[model samples]
Target: MKAAFAPTLEGWYERHRRDLPWRHTRDPYRIWLSEVILQQTRVAQGRPYYERFVEAYPTVTDLALADERELLRLWQGLGYYSRARNLHQTARYITEQLNAEFPATFDGLLSLKGIGVYTAAAVASFAFGERVPVVDGNVYRVLARVFGITEDITTTGAKKTFAKLASELIQPASDPATYNQAIMEFGAIQCTPVSPDCLLCPLQQSCNAYQTGRQQRLPVKAKKEPVRNRYFNYLVLRQNGKLVMRERTARDIWQNLYDFWLVETDEPITALTDLNLPDELAKLVQQGRLTGNPVPLTQLLSHQRIRGQFFLVDLPDTVSMPLPTGFGQYSMDEINQLPKPVLVTTYLNEWLG
Candidate 1:
C-alpha cells in the first residue's frame, strides 16, 4: 500500500487537479507568497489576494521594498496580520541577506522567518522539487483516515507518527511535488471534513476510515479551548468631518491595525459613564455630545469573540480638542487608506454611509 500510495495519488491529481496560478510556476518567491496568503484562508477566497500580491510585488526585491503600512493595507481583511508581517520580514531577509534567492533545501527553507515545517516542506517540494511531503491539515486528515491513525493530531507524538509515515510514503514517488499536491487536493475535495464524497472516492477500497465507517473520527483532534468573549467600547471622536483613530500597539489581537480609542470591559455596558473613563477622557466626552446611539458590532476570531460598541462623540468644530496620546485625527480619505480590523471597517461603512 505504501509503495503504490504516491502513484495512485499522483494519478488522481493528474485527473482532478484545479488549475491554480501558483501551480504553474516553480519560483520560490511566488510560491512562498501563495503559501503565506493561503494560510488559514481557503483557495476560493485567497486566490484574488494572491493575484493582487503577485501583481503588486512581483519579486522578493519588490516585496522587501514595499512600505509596511501599505503592505498591511493590502493585507487588510485577511485575518492573521502576523502572516503578512512575517512575509515582508522574510522577503527583506531573502533580498538583503541571501541576495534575493530562496533557500533550495527543506532545512534551509525552515530557517526563514515564520516558515514552519509544513510551509518548508511545501516550498521545498513544490518550488525546488525536493522529496519532502507537505503535512498540513488536509494531509493530516487524508493520512489519518486512509491509515486509520487515531492518535490525537495535536500531540507531539502524533505529529512524529504522521511525519514519519509521510516521509516514507514520498520515498517511492517519482515526482514528490505532484504526489504531495494530490494527497492534499484529495483530502480537500474528496475526503472533506463534513459529508466527504466517500461514495465515489478512488481510495475507498484502501481507506480504512471508509471501510470501517470511521471517516469522521479518524483524525482525532482534541477540542479547542473555549472562545474568550471580550467587550470593546470604541470612543469615536469626530470634529468637522475628520475622525480620531490610533494604531493598536499592544501585544494583542489586531496589532498594527488602526481603530478608535478602545476601552475594554469584562462585561457589556449600556452607557458611556459605565466605562469610568479617566478624567481626560471624561472631559473630552463632556465636551462632545453623543451622536444617536452606540453602534454595535461583533467579530469572531480564532479563539476570541469581540463585541464592540462604538460611541460617536461629535465635538464642536469651532475649536480643536486635544486627542488622547497616540491618537490622531484623520479625514475620511486618510481613514480609508489605513489598515483596520474588519470590525472597524464594518462600523465605518455602516455608521458613516
Candidate 2:
C-alpha cells in the first residue's frame, strides 16, 4: 500500500508542480544553489536570490573566485549569513581541490562544509541520481502525518526513522530526483506547516493522522531556544569625506560583514549622553567633533533581539583617528562596493541613495 502511493505522488507532482527555475535543470551547481538559498527561507523569497546568484556566479569556479565581501553583499538581508560564508567555502573547495566537480556521492557531499545529511541527500539524488531519501522539514511533515509517525520532528533521531521509511517507499528504478522533488513540493504547497488542506489532499484517504484526526499534532516540533537581547550603539564616524567601517572578525553574529564602529550594552540607553567613547574620540568630542543626532534601529535574529542606535560623528583633519585593525575608510562610492549588514545598508541607502 505504501509502495502504491509513490506513483500517485509522482503523477500528482507532474500535474500540479509549480514552474520553479531549479526544477527545469539537472545541473548540480544550480540544484545546490537553490537548496542552499531555500534553506530557512520561503520559496517566493529565495527564488530571486537563487536567480541573482546563478547570474552573478554562473559556475562553481565563478562562485569560488568571488570575493567573500562581494558574496556577502549579494547575500545581504538573507539572514543565516553563515550559509553564505559556507557556500563560498564549499565552492572554493570544489573548484580548487575537487577540480570544479561537486561530490557525486551523498557521503562525499556531506563531507563538505555546511552540507548536512538533508542537503547532501538533496544534491545526491537531485543532481547525481542517487537512491537516498531527502528528509527535510517538508518530508518530515508529510511522512509524519501520512505514516502516523509520533517522533518529535525536532529531535536528531527522527531523521533516521523518516529516512528509513522514505527509502522503503521509493519505487525500484524510479527517478529519485523526481520522487524527491515531488515529495518536497508536495510538502511545500500541500502539507504546509500551517493549516494544511487535508480535505483535498491526495493522501487524505489513507493518511493515518488524518484518519486519527491528529494531523495537526503528529509532527511535533521541539520548542525553540529562548532568545537573548543585545544593545548596539553604532558610530557612523566620518572624516575628510570618508566613512569608517569594520569587519566582524570575532566568532559572533555577522562575521566577515562590514559594520560601523559599535558600542554594545546589556541594557538600552535612554540617551546617547552616556556614551563611553575611546580616549581619542572623547578628546575630539571635548572640542565637539560630533555632528548628527543618534539614529535608532532594531533587528531580530533567530536567537537574538538587537536594539541598535546610530551615532553620526564627523572628525576633523587635525584630530588623530584611532582605528583598530581590520577597519578601513571608504568614500560613499567605495562603501557601496563593500558588503554590509542589512541594518547598515538600509541606513546608508537613504544617505547614499
Candidate 3:
C-alpha cells in the first residue's frame, strides 16, 4: 500500500510544489529559521519575515549574538513572541555550549528551546536528509482524509496513530525533504480543512474520505475554549520627551517585550478615580509631573481582551518619577529603536504622535 502511494505523491509534488524562497536552499540554518517563523503563521505572511530574519541574522552565530530587545523588535507584529525568544536562546546555546553548531540528530534538535516533535522532524529531514516524518497540521489533514480518520486529531491517541502512519508511509527511496514538503503541500493546496478540491487532488483515487464523500469530516478537530476578556489601562506618561515603558515579564504575553504602563482590571474602569493609581502615579500627579487624566484604549488578543488607558504626563523640570524595578526610562525617539509589542506601537501612535 505504501509503495503504491509514494510514487504518485512524489510525482505530483515534483510538478506542483510552490516555488518558495526556502525551497531554493538546503542550508540547515535557513531551514530551521523558516520552520520556526512558519509556526502558526501562513506562508504568504511568513515569507517576508523569513527573508527579514535571514537578512538580519545571516548566520547562526549572528542570531546567537543578537540583542534580545532588537530580536523581539524584528519579530514584532508576528504574535507568539515566545518563538522569537526561544530562537534567540537556542542560537546562543548552540554557539556558546555546542560550539556554534546546530545539533545534527532529531533528538538533538528537539532539545533546543523551541524545537518540538514536528519541528525536530522537519529540521532533521529537510536539512539533514533524514527519513523522518513531518506531521504538522497540514500533514495531519492530508493523512486523516487519505486514511478516512474521523477521531478528533487533537486527541493524544489520534496524534500517535497519525505519527505511526506517517512514519510507515514516508517514502523510503525519496529524499525526506521532498517527501515532507509534498505531504504538507498536498494538504495545504488540495486536502484543505474547508471544501477541498478533491477532483484536482493527486490522491483523489486512493483517498478514503474522498471515496466516502466525507473529506470535510475526516480530520476532525476539537472545539476551542472561549477567550477570556481582560481590561488594561496603559499610562503613557511623558517627561521631557521621555515616555515611561516597562518590560513584560514571564507572567504575561509578549514577555521580555516593552509596553506602556499597564493597569489590569477584571471589568472596564469607567472613572479615572476608580483606578487607584500606584504611589508612583500619585506622586507624579502630586509633584505636578502629570498633566492629564487617564484615557481609555482597547486592544484584543486571541484568548484575551484588553481595554487600556493612556495618561499623558508632563513632569516638572526637577522632579522624576521612580522607575519601576527592572524597567528603564527612554526618550520617545530612543523608544523607537527598542523592540516594543504591537499594542504598544498602536498606543504610541495614538498618544505620542
Candidate 4:
C-alpha cells in the first residue's frame, strides 16, 4: 500500500498544483517562515502576512535583529501571538548561534524555537530535498479517508500511525518540494474537509474512501470542548490629544501589546456607575485627568466574551498617570505603532467614531 501511495500522490500532484508564492522559492528561511505562519492559520489568510514578513524581514538576520515590539506590531491581527515571538527568537538562534546558517537536517531545524515535528519535516523535505513525509491537518484528512482509519486524528496513537504511513509513502526520487506541495495541495483542494471535488481528483478511481462511500466519515476528528466566555471593561482615558494605553505582559493573551486600561468582570456591568474604578483611576478623575465620561464597550472572542467601558477623561495636562507595574502611557499616535489585541482595535474604532 505504501509503495502505491507515493506514485498515486505524485501522479495527481504533477498535473494539479496551485502556483503559490512560496512554491517558487526553495529558500529554507522563507519556507520555514511560511510553515510557521500557516500553523493554525489558513493559507488564504496567511498569504498576505507571509508577503509582509518576507518584505519586512528578507533574511534570517533581518528577522533576528528586528525589535520584538515591531515584530508583534506587524503580527497584530493574527491571533496566536506566540508564533511571532517564537519566529523572532528562532531567527536569532539560527543567526547568532548557528552563524546565520540554517540547520540542513531535520533534527537541527526541530531544535529551534516553535519548530515542531511537522515544521521540521516540511522544511527538511521541501527546502533540503530530504525524502521526509510531512503531516498536517490536510495529510491527516486525506490519509484517514483513504485508509478508513477510525481512530480520533487528535490522539497520539493516530499521529504515530499517520507519520509512519506517510514516511513509507514519500517519494525518494522526486523533488521533495514539489512532492510536499502536491500532497498538501491535493488534500486542500481535492480531499477537502467538507464536500470534496472527487470528480476532479486524479485518485478518484482508486480512492478507498470514495469507493467505500465513507468519504465523510473516514477522517474522524475529536470533538472540541465548549468555548469559555470572559468579560472586559476598558477605560479609554484621554487627555488633550493623547489616549492612555497599556502593554499586556507575558501572562495575558496579547502579551507585549498595547491596549486601553481594562477592568474585567464575569458578568456585564449594565451601568457606568456600577464600576469600581481603582484608586489610580479615581485619582485621575480628581486631577482632571479624564476628558469625557466613561463609556461602555463590549467585545467577543472565540472562547471569551468581553464587556468593557471607555472613559474619555480630559487631562489638565499630559501628566502620566501611575500605571500598573510593567505598563506605560502612550500617545494616540504611538498607539497606532504598537501592536494591540483585535478587541482593543474594535473598541477604539467604535468609540473614537
| C-alpha local distance difference test of each model | 0.91, 0.85, 0.82, 0.80
Candidate 2 error regions (>4 Å): 171-173, 225-353
Q: What is the lDDT of residue 92 in candidate 1?
A: 96
Clashes of 1: 0
lDDT of 1 by residue, 68-94 (tens): 999999998899999999999999999
Lowest lDDT sum, 10 consecutive residues, model 4, at 289-298
- Model 4 segments more than 4 A misplaced: 171-173, 226-353
Clashes of each: 0, 0, 4, 10
Arranged by TM-score, best first: 1, 3, 2, 4
User: Over the stretch 1-353, how does candidate 2's per-residue lDDT look in tens digits?
Assistant: 68767887888799889999998887899999999998989999999999999999999999999999999999998899999999999999999999999989999999999889888989999889999888888999999998899987777798778878988877552788889889889999888888898998888898998999998886978769788999988877788888989888889998988998788999987555577877865665565355666777888888888888887778777777667666778898888888888888877876635
lDDT of residue 29 for candidate 2: 91
TM agreement with the true structure for every prediction: 0.65, 0.63, 0.64, 0.63
Judging by TM-score against the true structure, name the best candidate: 1
Query: Cα RMSDs of all predictions?
Result: 17.4, 18.1, 17.9, 17.7
Q: Model 4 reaches what TM-score against the true structure?
A: 0.63
Instruction: List the candidate 3 regions with Cα displacement exceeding 4 Å.
Output: 171-173, 226-353
For model 3, residues 1-353, the per-residue Cα lDDT tens digits are: 56777777778888888999998777788899999999999999999999999999998999999999999999998899999999999999888998988898899999888999999999999888888899999988888888888889889999899999999888474677788888888878777889998888878888999999988777888767677877776666666778777778867788888886676788877654565777877777566544455666666777676666666667676886677676667987888888877767886777666
Better of 1 and 4 by TM-score: 1
Better of 2 and 3 by lDDT: 2
Give lDDT tens digits, candidate 4, residues 3-105: 6666778787777777778888889999999999899988899899999999999999999999999999988888999999999999998899999999998
